[model samples]
Target: MHPRLKAVSFAVATLLAGAASAQSATHIAVTDAPDAQSATADAPASTALSRVTVQGARVRELPISSGALGARTDLETPFSTRQVTAEDLDARQVKSLGKIFANDASVMSLGDTFSFNAYSINVRGIPLDDYNGYKINGLPFFMTTVELPVESFESVQLLKGSSGFMYGFGAPGGIINFVTKKPTDKTLFSADLGYRSDGVFSEHIDAGGRVGDDRRFGYRLNLTHEQGDTYNGANVQRNSGSLGLDARLTSALTWTADAIYQSRRVKGGVQDFFLDDFNGDTLPKAPSGRKNLGAAYDNTFFNSNVFFVSSGLRWQIDPNWSAKVDVSRSQDRRRYSGQWMGLLNGAGDYTVYLNKAQGAATYEQAQALVEGEFTAAGLRHQVTLGLAWQGLNKQTVPKSLYTPIGQENLYAPITPLSWNGSYDDSLQYHNYHSAQKAVFASDTVQFSEQWSALLGLRYSDYDQTSFNTAGTVTNQYHKTPVTPTVALMFRARPDTLLYASYVESLEQGSTVGQTYVNKDEVLAPLKSRQYEIGAKHEGRDWGATAALFEIDRGAEYANAQNVYVSNGQIRLRGAELNGYWNLPAGLRLTGSAAWTAGKYRETDAELVGHRLEGIPKWQGSIGASQKIPGVEGLSANAELHYYARFDADSANKYKLPGYSTVNLGVSYETQIAAHPVTLRAGVDNVFNRNYWGFLQSGYTFVGAPRTLGVNAKIEL
Candidate 1:
């Protein structure tokens, strides 16, 4: 066994032993009391102990939204999905999307918190589309360089496969949906104070309740502010606010509205390293992750703002029929002025370059759906019919200014040159527009008590246009496609489900980055197909799932000429296993493992069968939480993540070494003056391991350093 694994095992064993001994001592003291008076004196302690129960068991049963298909539990859904509730977010001290999915083997980080202002990930070895892969309450939103406030959401759901039939057009990678917090039946109010490593501090407030004599009006409000220096020698400030309102117009109809606004600013942001100019045969060793190689005079920063508004209505037409209609609009704006370093040789000598640009994307969507059940041909059928329309408008400056600045050495660095450039934001023009209209339907037929089949189809008309600053059309694309999905499910037992599904999707293509030779070029849309087989088992004290999946789609990459093009087909096959167990003696365990094999086909001879870049063949995580036997509301939790080595480039010439990281945390819950309070503290990357975290588009980023976080929450 590996030395690190052995050490971790020994530590867990020691902790369990100590907890058992403590519980034994408490039992002896209580039984050997001098008199009845002594037992009465310990009544408060007993009460506190009773209040502490197992945590995280309720997460598995949370209902998940399936777009127009309606809501369903994990066991009822034919696809693999996961939900992270607000409680899980607080307990894990999550600050970014990457942190929220740290323990998920099916998701891998493309950019960490410190590497970029916005977070990105690869699901099933494919990167999600920034414009189509993210949704808020089943509506589309642009997510490039935008990070929403986590406190404003009640839960986040992840669907792990193609969703063409569910949503009109999207990437085959997956979908991430953010569910907003709504007014509650009982009055709720809470305040939180938090501190992160390097002097970052935050304060947040949340409140929700109903109003009026009839209790027909409801409202939920959230406000947050955070500002401080970051681990990478950068200063960041953020402010955000959100409100949700609902009105019960009649006995069976409800109207809901939500609005959100956030502003994020950063100074002295981290610089990404570009290896396009490197002449060495092998990559250089990574430096200390905490080292600040950027210049003080660089004056690099990013200013981002996001605004969203949505309104919807839900009507119960009858006892077994329901209808919903929703419309939403959102805008994401960002201004970036930063430096990217270009490596010159193996010695790490590099030249700094500056870039300044501003851009914004506006998205509008409307959807209507109806769901009902009926009996047809001696079989019970559940049906859903929906229509959806969505459009996007992208605007940007005519050109981004790029210039070479100064030079520096990696091992022996010198001071940076002063900033000598400026940005012009006056002339912004529309660069791209896209629209989609679709009608979709699905039927689930139950042939017997234990057998069912689902058939779904969607027909869509998609239009895309790209224009130059002069309003001249540069590119245009139009297509009409029909996507379909079919699934068969069987109930092996009362609590076990086995299913097989086939799905097809139409995915939006990629846009060439500014660094590429052919900048501002938009590729044509691609078609993708997926096949999956899985089994799920739900028990009183445990839940488990296993799945095997394969995906095939058109591949695009930067060739030797530094031009981005689509010339081949990419195929990915993988297997995943996940489970959780609520063990005896206040111990809980969770684990997941994934193995993926990827290859390129029908491409250049030299690139045939080459492995995909930035994808690990094996990844997994294990976590354990143990409650203190004699102490009430106190628990210690630890998690370990492992990633196997994989190729860093399409040529398969360089390989990144495998690495592992560990995170540890503890929390205590108690009452102060009749109010409930909880305190938590945690440290990530406990060993301070230094390694490369991501490699994409010829840019490589280093992993984050060890960091600490402490938080306190009080309920009133």
Candidate 2:
């Protein structure tokens, strides 16, 4: 066994032993939007041992939005769910979505440091692109090829597994709900400044308040700017701003609006290297982590502007029933310019292609639902019936040119070659539109105090059309897909629950990834299914979850005869164990481990039983934090992440090395000039270990090297 794995095993064993032998400890259920430093408060002395229960397990729930299903506690939901709170963001100094989920065993980051505006992740061995994996308060919104404006969000909730019954068509990975910061009755103001080892500087301002004495008018505004060198030694600058407003028209109705703008520019950015670029089948040694191998003239520019408005009317017609209607529309204009460079050989010779494009996309969406409490056959039940509609219209024009940047050694790079300004006019304008309408119903039946069941079904109608540059319809599709979910839960103990679920999800045909012979052709919609069994335990200061799951997704690939077809499937089976504990004193621990096996089950002979590329069979992470006994407002934390070796190609011709990394952080809270202030600093990859970062898409990039960052926030 590897020395690192043996060490991890020993540590885990010690932790388990400690958890079992420790004396009584204080436990606090995590709440929504908790005060930043509440967790560090000293625990009160008590003679009796107290049982810890999850906040959601109780009748009173946190004041937060719960996607399409409305507000419900974690225990009320019939799926695996997790929330990343605002406090977590500040404590970790999380600047990117990738860093936010780094410790999560179920998620894997695919975007490298220089991916500038792009953000992608794989959930439970299933990859979800920026477009269809995100939501803003239950309304489907596309991140496209841009980073999410995480500063404007109050909290992020992840519903793991299939969510087709709640969301329309999407990957089975899961649903990510980004709840925006809402207008508060109390005045709020905050400012933050940050610096990174790469010479990056960041400034952010957030302010929100109720303007009118009646407190019916509220507004929240945020502005952020970041500029400097990235981990890959690439130059980047980003500017973004957002304004959110809310007005209460009546006791039962409310209106909300938001405007967001972002502009980013990147120079000398680099992406993952393809296996074909190397000299031999075996993977070559990676370049220096700090090396920027791209041409000096290579640049990428991205700009986006969005305007959105939404209104909701909630009526409590009677004591046992309530109805809500939500309507929203959004318009987004996006522009991109720059050349993409990819290494063509180990010698650092690269192929550069200029890609300039302008695009616009519009989304109109509405949803209505009625929730009622009733008794059926002596069993208490909560039922929800909802209807939703969404329409998308997109148009894009490509002014592209291709060129080659001459060879340059990775160890000693040279200046980029100049372009001749020649262009490619072969491609035409691309336009596409899609509409999705669905009706869904769910019932949570309490058979007894110890047993409950949840059942849901959704009927979706999706239509899409493609148009040529001349405005002629080139292709059209009309599809109706039905998805269903059923789950059963039993309370093994007052603080423990056992559950089993079976669910199905739907995904529209992919218009990206031209791996097939027929490139750029949209495939058919896909249907996927999942079966999972899990157990959850919540205590006063600790919680744990374990789950076993199997998933199958429809796939498409070229056959033996080189014919592109959609008669293929992929299967994944996995198990996960995750938990957190706040031990006696001010010590805290968090850990997670996952193992999965994925393969092409139904495909050509060469592909059958082959392991999925970029998916490690074993992964785990452990993190801990401790408060300084001598310092009242000081804490320190450390984390370790591990990944097993995996192949970089479906054919198993190239293998990437496994790696492990460590991170350390420190935070101090104090009062500065009568204002609460927090200072935080952290360093990742402390050992400066070099490793290969493999993506499910068969791309590879060098992992980040040792880097340091610090940030300070003051409540004004």
Candidate 3:
């Protein structure tokens, strides 16, 4: 990845202002190889010019100032930021949120079929349990109830570290903020309608407009609908949308409000069974060597409802200073009513899987943030403050509908995948809980137009009091934590920057602080800390960056009921390199590679010196798009990703082999009927190789099998 001496010399000369700028030099860098940009551009044949981003920020000729203490939303930006631009998103033809997750290295999704195409994202192999709240448009509000429509977003931004200073009480690993596309001054609108390899169809809309003279006010709306079958036949369908309005409240004081709504009725399939549940519990007993129940296994189904509202306002406050505030409210509701034949019959205690779960769960949260920034003598500074509150409600009732007999019939036999029992709707259980409130703040300071530093802190106090529908307290717990972050950056050159940062994060145990019997003692909070250092160089034609990081996470154990504190501590150390290069003659390329080592410090982790459970030791990807020099309307793209082998459990008990997959795409677009149109087609897993990103049941969910997509669009 090192540049040749000539490339570096040209770069230095440009900085020294001693060289005749290279053609397209405004958009590219001399140090980048001619074809480097192809690695990042989408549809190499794209006739439109390309824009490359280093970290999360755009590699523009002019720098835009913000009130944020550095880049608050991108972990890669500070030193290890990663970005997936709108163009790449479109060319990849991603439809679900899980697919979009590929934009980053630290993320891996369980896919669309598990929770009715719902998702469980593993960041650095750590599950997201809402310790660090998710945000929308820089607000602590969450989209509690729905799937994301790719066409509705300008892009998704991920901020790693202690961001609580701005959003309040979140996981230390980092924060992910979904930046919805804002309405622009254009009166015309656009739409995309297509179907994927799976038996699913989708339609999305994007519309916006300017409000008055000078067009200071603007509004945008995004809507999406998709319904289809998974590789497994589980039914899937979702509807989600976003509406935003930005008013130039005097140019110096603007008000922006955006709302997001989503609803899904997805049927779940029997997901992976916990290793402990299979061994110790001895319930839901499957014969040994069983990796998965198989594609032929009947699926369990569940339905859920989700919704949220987010809004923000910006005030010039004064020419030298500006202030902004944002708020978001969200609700999540789930209804699990399914019949898993052997699930409830768990050879001995199948009740765990309970072929029948007539239960309902709902959780809601609210958060707000206020920020101010200033500019003086080439120096810029930004400060942000925030608060968060969250609550959870639950209810359960035994159903006789699936049980053949009445009351006692709740134990009736279940049809592996069908609900053929009677409904009782008699026996019932319910518990309600809530999270602690947190307040936080942080300062980001930039000096001499080249150096920047950020510091932030947050305090949280949580009180959980759960009760039975009978109005009796069933559990009570409390805890509090204080977290902080510090980061420093040195701009080696206008186009290059280097930085280092340290951050702390905490997560409340969902079942940790419960007031159970002597066997169910209260659980302690989980903690994590991260350190990272790296550098970046971005320009129009080429952009690249490299970084090293280490993260330490505290204990996760099972309760005294003889539990192992499922939350053991873990440590991760590694480095990643990624970037894009676009050169003359229509050649472009971009890619990333990483080597990681992780392990557990506690727990009877059988694999003492082994990598952390289920985490990969090495993983990386590279992609390229190219124009055939003289091919006016033709372009091609190729991408390859590799994941190294690693264990699946804490004991270093089982190993999941490493695998690699490749994707290729091509397209052609031009004026047809004077109405411009674009045509695209791509195949994932091009070789149609059968592989698994991780072990599932007896069979790993097949990596998206050789898949295909064709899209066409007309701009008005």
Candidate 4:
């Protein structure tokens, strides 16, 4: 076994042994379950003790962080957001972001999990910035071609639209924050064994408890491993480990730390197809997803490793005031060798080439914040003040190798010529660096019982530099911008809220790719603005939200000359509705629908009024869950997703057909040897549909076919 694997295995065994010994020596009482209404109040204890194999009676309220603005519930915040809990992850057996948001109308996958080294997604017809789009515990992290292990997180939260005041600099599309699981008040241990069709198997272990005298010290640990052949003739192996620790030094002071590591490798992975040279007016027929077009000796693989650590302290100064400070560091390393096929004509003929590269990215961040509530001038006010600093450094090979191998037909497959090439770590050099510093403040004033207003502002200093192969700076940029946000909210009733909000944000410029004439050139920063109006209602057994939004953002794309440049403006207007009902007779129903109209507003006359590429006009999903009346602890669920046809390119000369898919799952819970056990089975793409999953940068990926998964879990 590899040295790292051996060490991980030993650590997992040691932790499990220690937990088992502790369990046998002492008895820890589990806390009472909190009602759904108070789900966000005592989340750690309540969620840890609750059953997660089946859907709960109501949607649990989850708190989301608004960067420097602090934490707020959906009904309290003036933004569109969604939260996926740990229970949802377990019940669906989701392993990737694509599957996690499959039923979300506002999110669309940009890459597939099985074919790409890492998955990517877009919101509101705009792609997320790799550097600024993601966060861990509200701290910035690198997310380009990186996938985190879902098993280690307590919940995944999504914030939609421009957030310049909330976060320093980011994509206008949205922000995704991953919340880590913390130590539990009671002793807990669980293990799971799982299998997927095509010979994939996995094992996972989770443990948490309070240790030390007086139970002042706490710890949480998770370990996972999976290895096997995939449904598309590829082999994958993954291993991960995570640890969280906390110490309560006093009644009002607490210190916490977290560390996570993961390594994944894939062999014979599917390659993406490019259609830049194709002149056809319509997309060609898609091939079966199960077919492997590459040769058996195709030397292709992807390897990735990630490590992260963070430490923080929370201080409660009296009852109405609090303070927090945190620091974090993260590193991502990747190596890959693959072939990309480029279409040469209207027919299925294509040319193949080899691409090889290795790179690494390191990020560091520090932040401090204070929040307080006070009454002044006969008005109540909640205030927040914070400061943050973050930096990123990237290393890449001096030069990537791209050589043509041979030719092949998509319909009639044939083995192409192979070239011998490998990546050399010794040739790596520093390629890019960026830094940001910002101070922000926000005030929410309650003028009356039914009226309130919010005002926020952030001043950010941003700098970036790009280096050539010889370690000499080629380009540098510096900017100081002030972003602001304003909102007005009215409480119609205790359970309903109506609000209007406006926000502005600044985004990092795009980098030109090798295929463009201006390769390696970095454009100037782009500014975006958003306006939205929304309403939210939270009932005893039902809830719903509706919103209308419009955004104007700077546009950058390859021009007719194939030179990438920033010019013109892009406008997008949309409306969305989402609701859930926990009805009688053990039945629950949830649905969502979205309508978007995207167009090129100004700039090039020929491109004006053109529809945005890869964004559908309409998308929606409906889901149903039912519990068996005769048998206890048994439940079933089904969901269906639909999409409308969309443009395939900016010129609007080609179009890709839309398709629908269905997923079904069933779960059963029982007791075995006085221990609680749960079994689950699921099937995806029940109709075995074959269609284009996603399109980006003139490249298309084939969707996955029918697949089955089964798992059994036991808690002690």
TM-score of each: 0.91, 0.88, 0.77, 0.91
Give the per-residue lDDT of model 3 (tens digit) for 1-716: 11222233234324323211221111221111001111111121111112222223353332111113423333224634334445656666765555655534556655433342235455555655543445555544333224554565555555444443444455555565565666664474666666656566777666777778788767777777777765544566677777777777684777777777766665644333333333342222222111222222244556666566766666656654545555556665555544222222234333223334444444455555566687777677677676666565555542223331111111233333333445455566665555657777777788766778878777878776666568688767677777777878777776666677677776655443111232223345567777776656665556555656677777553333535454567777765555656656566666665567777676554534556655676766666667645656677877776777666555554455667778777767666777656667777766666544343211123345566666666555
Candidate 2: clashing pairs of residues: 27-540, 27-541, 28-540, 52-539, 52-540
User: What would the per-residue lDDT of candidate 2 be over residues 501-546, giving only the tens digit for each residue?
Assistant: 7888877666543233554556677789888777666665676766
Q: What are the per-residue Cα lDDT tens digits for candidate 4 across 235-323?
A: 87889888888888888888889899999888876667777767566667766677676552377787889999999998889899989
Worst 10 residues of 3 by lDDT: 29-38
Judge candidate 1 at residue 458 and give its lDDT.
93
Q: List model 1 lDDT by residue over 161-189, tens digit each.
A: 88889886778888988877777766778
**Cα lDDT computed for each candidate against the true fold:** 0.75, 0.67, 0.52, 0.75
Poorest stretch of ten by lDDT in candidate 2: 41-50
RMSD (Å) per prediction? 9.3, 6.9, 8.7, 10.9
Off by over 4 Å in 1: 1-62, 115-117
> How far out, in Å, is residue 326 in model 3?
2.4
| Candidate no. 3 TM-score | 0.77
**Ten residues in a row with the worst lDDT in model 1?**
39-48
Span of 10 residues, lowest total lDDT, candidate 4: 41-50
True-structure lDDT of candidate 2: 0.67
TM-score of 1: 0.91
What does candidate 2 score on TM? 0.88
